[model samples]
Target: MIDLTKDGDLWTVTLNRPDKANALTEAMLEKLVDIAQDASAARCLVLTGAGRVFSAGADLDAARAGLATSDLWERLSSAIADLPCLTISALNGSLAGGAFGMALACDLRICARHARFFYPVMKLGFLPQPSDPQRLRDLIGPARTKMILMGGEKIDADTALAWGLVDRVVPQDQLRGTVDELSADTLSASPTHATAIKAMI
Candidate 1:
């Protein structure tokens, strides 16, 4: 359910299961972890999805089927957080649940104008994993993160940008071009310098 392609020094990873709104499965997360680990050789890495979502988060059916193990979640989160290349989430559509964690793990995010961000675990009588709370606080401050987690409020692209959940918003049609431009800029930097800066942050 994932596709990887290289263009010059940039690596693009696309979530390919549009039929399910790109909801992530255990297998998909495993592949994602592998790709993130391997992307170190690329100057930049872009994460996006096909069709209407960057990802809808975990596949509910798979999760209910006991396919999402705690060990696997930890491995996937660590792999994303420790990625060596400059990583960008090209949020081409709305995201929810565990997908928000993936976006949070990225070094930066460029979201589409129509995209919405939400984490509704509270409604499901569950809490997000530990990394999600910490990452959300680090990205958007504790107060806002608390509101998101506690209140279960969904934020639109503009509000997400204003609240620092996303770095920028682009028109849907411009998402690919915008990501290409940003990745090209990232590729223009010295790999060592870029890696150092990302590590420092």
Candidate 2:
């Protein structure tokens, strides 16, 4: 359900289930953890969706089938968040539910102008993964965190950029070039400095 490509020190991991809007399954999250462990040599790691819809969130079916999808997802997000290299979430399309945590876990988020963002835990009556609220607060502050967690607010790309949920928003066609430029700018630093700053932050 995912594809990994490496060019020099850049590693790109794409969620490949376009037909399912890239909805994350337990298997996908497991693969993510494995790839993340192997990405130590990468200068940067980019996470994105294949066709569109970065991810619709955790696969409900898998959860219903007794898979500990949320636990696995939490582990995957933590693994990515702790990566030594610069990390980016290229939101080529909208992100929702657990996907929001994935994007938030990234050091920087570059989103498509039309890409949307939201978390529906309130609406679904489900408690989020243990660390999600703290992660949300870290990105957008406590008040905004309440707005999303309590109010179930849905934010579009422009609003996401303005609200500190994303670092940049680009039109669909410019999404790739924008991410590439940012990646190149980040990678220009010496590896020592790059990994140091990543850990410092």
- Candidate 2 residue pairs in backbone clash: none
Candidate 1 at residue 104, lDDT?
Answer: 84
Best-fitting candidate, measured by TM-score?
A: 2
Q: Tens digit of lDDT per residue, candidate 2, span 1-201? A: 899998888899999999998988878988988988787788999999987689988787975674433577677778888888988999999998877777778889998888978888888777777778998898789999998888988888888888888998888788778878988966788999888877776
Error of 2 at 97 (Å): 0.8
Off by over 4 Å in 1: 67-69
For model 1 the local lDDT of residue 110 reads: 95
lDDT of 1 by residue, 1-201 (tens): 899999988889999999999998888988988888887788888889998788887798887776443456666667777887877899999988877777788888999999998888788666687688999998889999988888988899999999999998999889889887777766888988888887787
lDDT of each: 0.84, 0.84
Model 1 worst lDDT run, 10 consecutive residues: 66-75
Q: How far is candidate 2 from the true structure (C-alpha RMSD, Å)?
A: 1.5
Q: Which portions of model 2 show Cα errors greater than 4 Å?
A: 67-69
Q: Lowest-lDDT window of 10 residues in candidate 2? A: 63-72
